[model samples]
Target: MAINARHRLPILLAAALPIGLLLIFESKLTKGADQVAPPTSAPSPPIAPTPTFTPPSGPPTPRTPQFAPREYACSRAAVAPTLDGKLDDAAWASAPWTDDFLDIEGPARTAPRFKTRAKMLWDENNFYIAAELREPHVWATLKSHDEIVFHDNDFEVFIDPNSDTREYYEIEVNAIGTIFDLYLHRRYKEDGPAEHGWDAKGLRTAIHIDGTLNDPSDVDRAWTLEWAIPWSAFSPPVLTQPGFTEAARNAAAPQIGEEWRVNFSRVQWTTTLEGKTTTKPLTAPINDSYTQEPPKETSVTFPYQKVVGKPEDNWVWSPQWQIDMHDPRFWGRVKFVK
Candidate 1:
């Protein structure tokens, strides 16, 4: 097994070369492992705490109920009543009187000083209205027809046939039977003007005063009013609207079981009569600072009684909740019955 020195030296060199190569590869592998980056993962999300339920502190609040307008059943007259201010006609016997008038601003305000009630009847041709207003001092000033009748104590009737609150009719009459009738395309608050030119043709009105008129001397019982309004009187010129037809502009007699919106109002003013007085003129001053003689002074007296208060009282069949009467939404529902 012993070899020559030169051969042994060559074999050892070859073996040493293989061993050196292996050692170099192992060293390289060790260095690569140290240089390698560590495996990394995304940071975990923060854990959330559980929520606790807390009840409300107090009881729940209650809601207000919606307001509903009053209703009336208007009966039909078997026969037409005579256009007299008296309610003794057989046609009005079946008609029931409306509730006593209340303040226009509702029951929250003071009640009306006098009692007022109205009844309604309808025939084939006309709509009838009868009112009995118990007033101690009955007086009126305006006389001309179509003049502002409300200037004097007056009774007013508002009718919305279709209950649309538009194309309504208003008729006002005073104790003297002076009438102021008008038509409105819409409510006055909606910037609509009163069509004074529109008159209720074929309209009949009568007034009867149980007490002396325009005389404050004695206490009077009451005044009564009767109205026979033709159904044709409601037809005016054709009025156009967004969803209205030509026939809708013209009014027709209401059929049985139909409903309409209606309201009545009474305007009363506080008045007093001033006694006539005579005054004598004083003699002109001795020192004449005036260019001409001092004007003679004479007594002056009003021919009629004077109104003491600035605003008149407004009594209505149904309270409007506000002072405005043009809002037909608050009017009572009148159902026509046979």
Candidate 2:
């Protein structure tokens, strides 16, 4: 191991060279590992916070009616009608008959096969309505009060005193004078229920059939119906809850010159008499002439009649553009006159 100084120095230099080379290689490897290549794609945008969602407060607005609503000048009655299902009284002379009813779906549909007309009058005590329906075969089946009178040929009245389309009143009466009355907080489309228990208190209705009822053998003339609804019946019950007072209720009677939303509907069915059934559909020819012969004052009979083919026809004073009678937005306007 004890060599000359020059030889020993040369060996040491070789060993140091190898070690230095190894260290250089190790340093290069570490530098390459620490270095990073440019990203192939843009760094993902910083994740954005999800936005909060909110819902509408109420139902969407309904489409406007295709046709303009009809209007009527409801005049004050000098004398209350006798409420005998007859429009012959002098009190009705001042009131004008409404235009003939058309298909509930509007003028786009065919005219009603039979003629129908109505008139209105109001007094301090009661509101009067009279309707005349020309039917070839006057018939009725359901007679129970509050029964679905529309199941039979029926006349219906809808009234919205505030014109707000809320808390409206509906009264349906059949030829037999069966009454089905209810109150609605909103339209059926708005998920409102018919409060059948709410009734038109002190309501009076009468029906006069000109032809023999339920008899298929004879061609009947028409049926006239009358209603006298007391103003007090329209007064809503007083709410006893907080923020409520007796003054919250509307006046018993409408003030002069006030306007209200109103509409009328008639439901007619296709029917045939038992044992006299025909294969042909029970549709009457369109009566071009709205005029009808006067009643003969003959005795009427109630024979069994069977409903035949298609569904009932809905004829209305104001065309709904849709078959729905519950939408007060399409109802006609009635301005109270002195």
lDDT of 2 at 276: 34
Error of 1 at 122 (Å): 0.4
Candidate 2's displacement at residue 255, Å, is 0.9
Error of 2 at 271 (Å): 2.1
Give candidate 2's TM-score. 0.69
Candidate 2 deviant stretches above 4 angstroms: 1-66, 237-248, 272-309
Q: Report how far off residue 307 is in candidate 1 (Å).
A: 5.2
Residues 1-338 of candidate 2 have per-residue lDDT tens digits of 00011010000001111110100000000074777877799788896542322222332245433466889999999888976775778988888999999987777666888899999999898888889999877666655666656546788999988887676888887766777777665565555545667767788877777766555667777888788888887865443455333333455788999899999988765444433333222333111111111111231123433343333567999877655676677788999889
lDDT of each: 0.64, 0.65
Candidate 2 lDDT trough over 10 residues, lowest sum: 21-30
TM-score of each: 0.69, 0.69
Best by TM-score: 1
Where model 1 places Cα greater than 4 Å from the true spot, the runs are 1-66, 239-250, 273-309
Clashes of 1: 0
